[model samples]
Target: MSNVILMIFTGLSVGAVYFLLGSGLALIFGLMRVLTFAHGAYLTACAYAGWFILRHSSLAAGPSIGTLLLALLVGVVVGGALAFLTERVLLRALYQRDHLDQLLVTAGLGFSLVALLNGIWGPDSRAVPTPPWFTRTTTDIFGAHIARGDFVLIGVAVLLLIALEAFLKHTRHGLVVRAGVENREMVRALGIDVRRSFTLIFTVGGAVAGLGGVLAALYANAVNTTIGDTYLLYAFIVLVVGGLGSLRGAAIAALAVGLLQQFANFYVNPGLGEILSFILMGAMLLLRPEGVGGKKIRLI
Candidate 1:
């Protein structure tokens, strides 16, 4: 029973990471209808940036809450800035183009960024230093041994999910963004600047991806060049299963995949967990092509 609980906790933690990454991808897809291949690079960049700050700055010699928060802040800011720049420079021209053009351009940018990362960080993986509070293996809470980081991740995920849903449903900016997502022409008709709306959405997506990168690095204790590509694939699957533009679906689907993957890894084999994820994705695609809450939209 304890083992089962442990797996569930671990799975939820992993799912939190996936949710953060997938939420950003889903947001971009929902609003911009752009399959943002460059998003992976954004994640990688934030991870590296945060890691570098933590390792090289005056905070390098010690682990403290200030260092942790500052590192995450650096990651989020850098990620948002990178995404904003990419949209303004590389992607603005292609917004009106076909999906093929968007894909090609973003994919090219992703590859370029990956190459750039190699040049700058080299091929070696980098580890993030967490605060002393997070390093403990377990904390005694009501007589149950639980991993400190796992439940923290889950709690963070839950809070983020609620905050996001509330923001989209309640706030004026959120309503405008949602309106833009449903109909840009109508939004423009209302005198809202659709381009600016898109910029805001893209920037938010980048921030979410950045947060996920920081969490993943902390959880795994390392970040590498290929992390973006690898997690991007997983994010795609999660988005497909959860439905595009649906945060609730993403949350549910993330937990499902995370649980399944963890269970398979424990009961079956390590590699088999990845295989199972794809198998689940394939089944979802076959049985419900539109995904859980996703509407059917033509992807050309």
Candidate 2:
């Protein structure tokens, strides 16, 4: 039972990362109708950025809450900037194009971004030591050792989820974005700048992805050139399994995937464990094309 509880915590932590990454991808795809292959690239960039800050700055592993907060803030800003540029330079042009063209263009952009990241950060693995405050000690929970970092990640995920929900439900800017999603033509007719809403959505998505990167870098204790690649597929799977544009769906789907993956890894071979995630995703796709959550438009 203790082991099971431990696994659940671990799964939740991993799911938090997936939720963060997938939420962003889903938002971009849902609002802009652009399949952004560059999402992973943004995550990779953020990981590298966080790594650089931790290595060079006065930040030390463990309980440096202030430093972690600053790192996350930097991630949001940098990620937002990157998203804005990508939208302006690439996605904006492909908005009216066919899905195939958008796919190819975004795929190419992703490749370009990957190459750019490699050029700047090299292919070597870089360590991202946890803050001194976060690394203090592990707590025994039902005989399972839980790290403070894991709890922190889960807490952050919950807080972010709540915050996003509130923003989307109550905020004026969020209402505009939702309105645009439902009826771009109507939004434009109302003299609301739909494009601006798209840009905001993209920027917010990027920031979420960056937060995932930060959590991943700290959790893994290392960041590498291909780290983003590792989670990209999982993010897509989560997005698909969850309904597009549905934040609640994404969160629930992420938790399911995380727990499923953990169970597979524990009971099955690691290679097979990875395969199980796809199998489950495939089943979900076949049985329910709309995803686990039914699709509903908040706007007209």
- The number of the candidate with the highest TM-score is 1
lDDT of 1 at 112: 94
Best by lDDT: 1
Deviation from native of the Cα of residue 67 in model 2, angstroms: 2.2
Instruction: List candidate 2 stretches off by more than 4 Å.
Output: 58-63, 296-300
lDDT at position 202, candidate 2: 91
The lDDT of model 2 is 0.81
* Per-candidate RMSD, Å: 1.9, 2.8
What TM-score goes with each of the models? 0.94, 0.93
Give per-candidate clash totals. 0, 12
